[model samples]
Target chain A: MGTIVSILVLVLFLTAILTGGYNKKFLQRVQGSNMWDWLTTVDHKKIGIMYLGAGGFFFLIGGLEALLIRVQLFYPNNDFIVGDTFNQLLTMHGTTMIFFVAMPLLIGFMNVAVPLQIGARDVAFPFLNALSFWLFLGGGIMLNLGWLFGGAADAGWTSYVPIASNQFSPGPGVDYYVLGLQISGIGTLIGGINFLVTIINMRAPGMTFLRLPLFTWTTFVTSALILFAFPPLTVGLLLIMFDRIFGSHFFDAAMGGNSLIWQHLFWIFGHPEVYIVILPAFGIISEVISTFSKKRLFGYNSMVFATILIGFLGFMVWAHHMFTVGMGPVANAIFAVATMSIAVPTGIKIFNWLFTMWGGRLQFTTAMKFAVGFIPTFVMGGVTGVMLASPPADYQYHDSYFVVAHFHYVLIGGTVFGVLAGVYYWWPRMFGHKLNERLGNVHFWLFFIGFHLTFLIQHWLGLYGMPRRVFTYQAADGLTWINQVSTVGAVMMGVATLVFLYNVVYSRKSATAASAERDPWDGRTLEWAIPCPTPEYNFAQLPKVRGLDAWWMEKMAGNKELEPAEPLQPIHMPSSSYRPILMSLGFFVSGLGFIFRTIEVGVLGLVMVFLLMFTRSFEQDHGYHIEVDQIKEAEKGA
Target chain B: MKANAEQTKNQTAVQTSQESAWKHVTSFAVMIVLTAIAFAAVATNLVPSHLLVPLLLTLAAVQVVVQLYTFMHLNQKGSGFPVAFMASGIFIGVISAVALMILV
Candidate 1:
């Protein structure tokens, strides 16, 4: 009964907030100070901005956690932080950076860019897209919410079992991990399905499969990967949840269960997840490289095939992570070869980028600089990856700083660099004004030097037998100087990030300083055809994709814009509804209930979920139609 | 927007839906028979337990194909991608399960 009352209060409060949280009514605030409009918006651009904001916020938090770890290890035998707090920091840093930072940042670009590039009005399921974002936010909150309750998960982000069992950990920390990932994983899975459908069905009339943008193509493959990859994660989390909340013995070795089961389940999803994040980065690099090179992407057909091949190979190499677990010589050998084979497609991409820029009039803008810089850094990481793939050599590098350096080299070098490129490349499209290019250059160079400085030396430290995930080292270990240098480099990276943030703020103040949003970069895609600060209705008339580089072809032909494929008509769009927020709140509340062991709260959450579904089913939502006159006015203003 | 083309499109859509319904009905009947045979083989104890496991496994695989092609409409146009993903997912799952059982 108490749970019921609190849930009711929460519902009423959320309703009030969604309907009347602003100074004006929700409808009025659509043109007023509309915080509520954002909460309930099904607009892809707004949701994409929200994703960028939330992901950026989480990136900062994760970065802070990294700084704390560095501070603890800056000196030998330093007493900066104790073991427990250090474990929490390490776990949160890994969990937050992978789930909260990289995934959402890429998805944000997908939301904003995919529909525009394909010449679609919105995603196939606009309402579900909104729900995916909200659920992600809810899950991120639940994972961090443990900081206030008792503790955050300290079993590492993988949450390997036996150690992660309820009896051993004995707290709500891992519980939050299990529940938080499950909730957010569902959102990711749905988001992937949405993208798959949108790309397949919503392409412009002439946008053939062979003619799709590389970003759209990567988005398509990544969605397929997410569809297949997230299941193993979902099942793994379910086993863990049962073990923690319901007294299952799935991972309890004493009960005839195997702990290796958890590892197998995790790496199945975990290995592909690396591709899930990196493939989009590959797509971003392809776009930036070709655009700045003032040429078409070299080896386009091979690039597409290589992307699909990589996704398939991603599933084949999960066992490589477990070579140390006595998986026998044959299994280890098979996985080792499989892992090394990934370099084939990756090498193809590298050479393609190089060839794309070989003879073109290259523009060394900040975005292109990052794209060019990513090549060497990412190749170095790939070299280390092959080195680590050998089980014989991995025996030496396992649990060492070498492994850490390899991934950071890949992740920071590949994913982070690609995100920065995309942000600089698309900032004018996302926001009304361009980011100050001078500051972006400073930001890029500082971040680049600092990144190499921090992780590159860690390779030597690992060879020196310095272990990873350790809080501190003994002074006699002779590891002080290298560690200090690494930390110093971290500080430089942090300072570079601050410069970027200052650029954002300083740029915002001078919003009208220039009107460069309209094809500022002389872009090649359909997205560049529109005026920057794109109108809500993205395309007045569907575009006919005559061929690849559709807009570029038109511009070259001296037709200011491609001929409209059809006359204007009233556009039917999905209604902007608040149920997505309410539905995610249901999952969030249930997560809280599970953590607290309150059955009633969990039940109430399910009830809210079902109740919303029931209401949505019976409701008649024909969707508001934007009149042809309003569209004419919008086009006139543009 | 030719009149004859529109009529052909609508006619094919109707025929496709009707064909799907029949396929589903036939597949459902076959699934029931396969399930009953498997259960009867176990219940009647006519076959040895050793042989029964393989028989049931083969029967189950066939039934799955039937369900996928007929009930799930995997044979339909535009289902090529989903089928491919599901097949690859199953292949990966089987490899992981087999390796875990044998090696680990």
Candidate 2:
């Protein structure tokens, strides 16, 4: 079956390329059928959409893995997917959802929104932006490929040392995990740098840092967190790779190597990774709340400061995760204190959102609903987080369903809600048409209720002394009903996801130009200043940001459009290239080679990558320009 | 001597360039001397073993600043953003390193 499917896929791919090559009519007939154009395009908007598409695909795979886990746990002592299979499912579910799904989804929104918000034509490095997206996707694909080759990674997402060491669990599973994350982590690191440069240097004239939109501010902070956080993960992965593959004993206790080093290194990256995902979500909620409430974000400066503080505090609190590993009481206390202190900035942000919505016209759009729902839901997670932060209390809660409940509330209720809200909020801006609001509300209500119902009971189950990562439990344990309820909620969430997918298709079929208004939602950011289907050149002339909420300020002054920061001139756009995808493919192949321990294959792949890089170093891509006349004509059409 | 405004501007520019050149050479000389002292200290055991590491580290840190300011032009105008990012990165790096040293 696998061989047949692979052959069919190859055939379909060949057909796609061959038809386009020989038949010009077929290419012109179907819009978006120019697959080559999309393959090589360096446009940030297109790359953003591709990120969403790929992220959504992985999300479904992860969600399916989740549903299977829930099913197995639905009944006590169920023979359904026992032992290693269950472990693989759970491991892949966590790893996929966190690294592939959540990160990419948030990065998708950032790519779609940040450049526009800053009033820049494109990201500082368009080619790198494209490269980042492809590398992430490539890494994601390689991660999933583990299932096809014997088994998937089953050592849990944390991949704790000694257990994950080849001597204990000898297989290519953990090797895939190491190489895949290393590749994707590099992508994320470079993406963060790209954003930092773009945000710092690419803002329009007169648009100072203080005047940046709340979302842009969050992206900036999140990028900084990514920069500081990912290197440790990379180093950890490299060490483990060496241990597993190259006969080194980085975590081998028998060889005088300490296992505790792995935990410290992992959490050092892992803890800030929590912030890296959530900060962007916080940014989304801020944007949605303010936009739908028809108010400027209250305590904007405080919100910015709070974001930075949270990011700073995030790095200091990683050891909290290792309290159970016994780093002594003093170390635990320090980590615990640092962890709980994060609540102060988080609390400030929560209150700031509430104040922004207070005494304003609160429009309950689908986006607004998700944003409002996020507040209480995220606060619940935050409260549980504080509860778990106490080192003494954590001794009871560690590796329990209570821990699972807390993170799901934060990850699903916070990050997922924020991603959903962003999708709804920016759908029109992104695709030039709005998602059906009625279906959107249905999706939101189901997801929100299903989310709480799913995890809320698990907190009690944890309290009832149910440990996490177990395949099955005895009926005498008396956890059957709660597990069943959680499964029901998981099923509901799965159905809600289907509804969202349906909404996407339903909206696309009915999309029309009239529905694609320039200022949909009467948005306040510089993004809404451009056309709904944002122009190829995002701004014909850069929008001069005079104050906070630049668009709203202009609207209040009775202007139809932004005050242009520059005279009408040709706009230089980075030309598309095939190198990013090819480079990613080279790396992907090399990762597989390393996992399988094939020296010739690995060398071949590395040589391909180096050749590409070598050529790129000398290659000059000055990019093409859109002349003023063409810009004027496009503007007239809009 | 009555000089034109352009000539006066040129003279000032030349003078500043010469001063910059002098500063670079002086910093380079100081770096060489520092390196020599470090070598002598390590070779001759002039400093106690307990304090030698700190001395070498201090010298290394000062040399880095000199290199950045003099050679990398970090002291020039329009370098505020780069300096700020570098400082933040260093701050985070040092804190993590120190924390690891203490705890690990």
Candidate 3:
């Protein structure tokens, strides 16, 4: 199977190269674009849009993988997908969703919204930001390339050591997973640092910490979480890479090494990683609910505190995931308590949302509906989360359908729903058009119903002693009906996503004139203060923030708009360049090289990557800037 | 306000040279103490191989704090956010590591 996949992947690559060479127009587009333009482009909005488009593409691919799994499980003892194929599908689905889907979508939101909320023109390190996005895209491509090859990664997304070890699973698939994620993880880390610096240093004058919008605040904390959470992952991946490529004994239990070390390293980055994925969604829900309800976010201080507390506790309870590993009752009990403690802060956030909606004028926009829907869905996910926190209870649930149901609810019901809400909420700012509300509602209902139908029953199945990750099951297990229902739900989700795609395309032609207008929601944040389809550099002159809800404060003071922080000054904007893309390409080539190092072509590929790196580093150029007068004139025209 | 400004300037100058010298001295002292303790543990066999790793890790933790305060100037003003972020990362790293050690 693996050999066949590899052959197919090679064929696809050859086909792409041939097609590129054959088409003059395509080659021109690829080669004619100035290399420097793409390498250094620092426009936050553009970077954000790129992230969204890339992330959306990956989401579709991951969702398709999910559909495949559902189809396989549709009937008892089904052979729609063989065992190895089933394993690969599950692995790719989990990996794609977490790494390719959730992470990029959150980063996309950050790239688009962070600078705007803070009244900054761009992130502090725009060049690095562009580089991060490219690296991420490269990683995503590498992970998915397994499809063309004989198979995708068959190790579960977590890729536990003994199973992922070279001796047990001798394949290039896991190598692709490790290298792809390592490259992308570097991008995520850089992005985290960029946002941390931007938020801390570049806030508009008088936009004090407390005065910042909730979304910006969450972005700030989330960046902090990323800074802290990603390094361990980097360390773990490096060890794995060394073990796989250089024959290191770090995770080889037979050697003087411990496999547990990898788990520690991975989960250290993993637990807070949940917050890294969810906090931004929490921020989005905060903004959406408040805007639609026409109220100040309830218990603003508590919400802020809860976010911080969750982030803090996120690091503490990672061990709960390890309870069944037999750390003994004392360790288990300690981890269990630590895990349960997270629920307090998470519960606080839920109530805060409900209170924000209480007694306020509620407009049921598509964005708001998702936000409202998130409460119950996430609560169910959360309840299962608490249940799983108990060590003894977890022994029964470990690696069962229950565990699968728990995370899907949290990730899909929590993070995916939040991302969808953000897209609806910011669609106008991003594309100068609203997603068709009618279609959006259809998308939401189908998705919500389908989501519950699929995973909600899995919990019962788990409780009834069904193991997860099984490619097939017998009719006698009584799992057949529930599996059929789950497949139906998966189909519904597929239809909903199709409707969403159509809505996006359809709205391009016939969106209301009102939809084209920026600040359609009479929004409180600084982002809505700018014109729709925000300018490339973002702000002409940074807005002076006076108090909480900076825009709202100005409105209340009868100023009608923000006062400028300074007279217009020329903004030193980074020019777009292709260095980042090229650098990532080098890694992609090197990955292929590592996977097939026995071949002479692989050696040549590795050498080429080294040469590319040296060439790229030596050829750096000072970025270009736009004059203040040009920005002023542009703003005036708007 | 003027007097405060003058005093602040004097303090800054004194602190700059003093802190620089102190930083060098403290780092040297820390290195010696850390080496001595490590050697002593090895000599006495007080640090078992299993505990040796954890002990070295603890030492590294101490060194990190020292580095942050002295080398990174995290204890000083204008260092708040970066320090906070670093601390948070370390906290998360430690928790995840400990969890993985027990769980896996």
Candidate 4:
């Protein structure tokens, strides 16, 4: 099977190169036309859209998984799904939503917004950006590949050890978990490094850290969190891979391997990983709230400090997740206190957002609705979080539906809502089209209601002593009504998601009026100062930043556009390459080989990967320059 | 190049190459001396077994410093992020390893 697959992959790849993907003339023609352009695109905009598309596709899969889980639990002693299938649905739902859906969608927004906000033509390492996407996608595909086999990971998304060990949960299921995440985690780490370099080294002449758009600021901090957080996960996953495939004893207790090592390493990465996913949302909320309110962000410096403080505190509070693991009173107390203190920074952000919208003339756009709606819901989540932080209370909440409620509040209310708000807010900038506001509001209301209905009941159910990750309960437990209600709410959310899908489709069908509005929403950031569907070379002439809200400053100064910081020069843009895709495919193939313990396949795959890297090093393709005349031609209408 | 009648375009190139050669020789001498002392300590059993572990670890740590500074040029100007990232990796590794050790 493996050989056949490899041979087919090689054939298809060679055919693509021979046909058009690599031929210089064919590449140029197809570059302006079809699938080859997307496959080999180094354009941050196209990559961002691809991330969005992939995230949305995964969201549907995860949502279906959620629906299946909820349906099984809708009634007492439900047989909607069996024990094994329930576990698969549960594990895949959590894993897919967190890793595949939220991270990529949020990264998508960053890819589109960060470069424009920083006034750069593209990311500093455009090639690495492409590599990041391919790697992430490759990892995602490998992870989902488990479904095509007999089973998928069933040890929960956390994949707690001893239970998840090969002796307990045999087969390729857990193998998929380790290798899939390891490959993807590498992609995410390099992406983090890429953004860190881009933000620090490629900002426009005057776009200092303080002057940067809030979303860009959050991307920077999130990338830093990724840098520090992902390594432990990589180490942990490699250990598990060794334990599973190579007959090593990394997490095996009979061999004197301590399981706490996995927990500590996982949560150390896990805690920061949540912040990694959420901080970008925080940045998005700041942008949306301030934009709709027609005000500069309240307490820009305070907001920046708050964001950094949250990132810093994110590292110290991983032990909170391990309170039930008998970490001792001193450790628990230290972690509990550290966890609660995080609220101070978070609260500062909350109030600053509120103050930004307090007295201004606010627009009640759909994005604004989500932003306004996020405040109270997130605070509710935060309130519950503080409750959970107390170790004593957490003992009761651990593995309970209440814990589920608390996190859904943070993840969904914070990240998902922020993603929707960003999508709605930037859709015009992203695709040069507007999603119908009335339809958007309908989608928002249903989702918001569904979110509250589902999670709100869960808090009570958890308090009533119901455990989580269980498929069903007895009717006599008196939990039937709430469970049913929770299921109903989840269905509503699914319906709400359908409404959003409709809005996107409808908006695209009638895109005649949506052409490139340079300053839609009267945006206050530098991104808005540029043309919509942003030019390939983002800023023809970089804008000089004079203040925090530079674009707003220019608008107030009665200038129709930003004053040019430099005379237009030929933009030195990086050429697209198929190497990243080839390299990632190598990782995917090798990962599959390891899972099945096929040494020859693994060797060949790795050799192919390294050879591609060697070829890339030797090939000196100095990317073509966009001429000043071409820039003038493109900017003619503007 | 060493011919008496030959002229070099840049005079400083000769001096700079000679200076680098001396530094390399000095570094090599220091490394050899350190290794010899470490070998003598372990082979002669002058250090107790438990104490030997610490002694070797100390020597190995010193050797790593020499390797990085002399061979890797970590002291150079462009090595900031690499140094920071490496230090962070070490810090996290130590924390994890210690936490697990204490827990068990």
RMSD of each: 2.8, 3.6, 4.6, 3.8
Compute the lDDT of residue A147 as modeled in candidate 1.
82
Looking at candidate 2, what is the lDDT of residue B89? 80
Better of 2 and 4 by DockQ: 2
Candidate 2, DockQ to 2 decimals?
Answer: 0.49
**What order do you get sorting by DockQ, best first?**
1, 3, 2, 4
Q: Which TM-score does chain B of candidate 4 obtain?
A: 0.69
On a 0 to 1 DockQ scale, where is model 4? 0.41
Fraction of the true interface contacts (Cα pairs closer than 8 Å across chains) found in each model: 0.73, 0.36, 0.82, 0.55
TM-scores of chain B alone in all candidate structures, in the order given: 0.82, 0.78, 0.65, 0.69
> How far in Å is the alpha carbon of A115 misplaced in model 3?
0.5
> lDDT of model 2 at residue A565?
84
lDDT leaderboard ranking: 2, 1, 4, 3
Q: For residues A1-638, what per-residue lDDT tens digits would candidate 1 score against the true structure?
A: 33454466568756765676554655575635477688888988888899889999999999999999998999998998868789889988999999989999999999989999999999999999999999899899889977877799988888888878888788788988888888888889999999999998999898998988899899999998898889989999999988888888888888888888889989989999999889998999999999999999999999999999999899999988888888888988999999999999999999999999999999988899899999999999999999989999998998899999999999999999999999999899988778888999999999999999899999999999899889988899889999999998898899999999999998888778365567888888899998767989899888989988888989999978766777899988887888898888888888777777786787777788889989999999988989999989988877
Q: Write the per-residue lDDT of candidate 2 for residues A1-638, one digit (tens) a residue.
A: 33343334335545765897899887766535578789888898999899899999999999999999999999999999899889899999999999999999999999999999999999999999988998898888888888987578889999999888998778778887888898899899999999999999999998999999988998999998899889889989999998988899878988988787787788889999999999999999999999999999999999999999999899889998888886899989988898999999999999999999999899999999999999999999999999999999899999999999999999998999999999999988998898999999899999988988899999999998899999998999999999999999999999999999999999999998689888789899999999767888999999888999999999999999999989999999899887898888778767876787765556666786798899999999799999999999998888
Q: Which tens-of-lDDT digit does each residue in A365-457 have in candidate 3?
A: 999989888999999999999999988899999889999999999999899999999999998999888888999999999999999999999
Ranking 1 against 3 by lDDT, winner: 1
Q: Is the docking of candidate 3 incorrect, acceptable, medium or high quality?
A: medium
Question: Which candidate leads the pack in TM-score?
Answer: 1
How many pairs collide in each candidate, listed in order? 0, 0, 21, 0
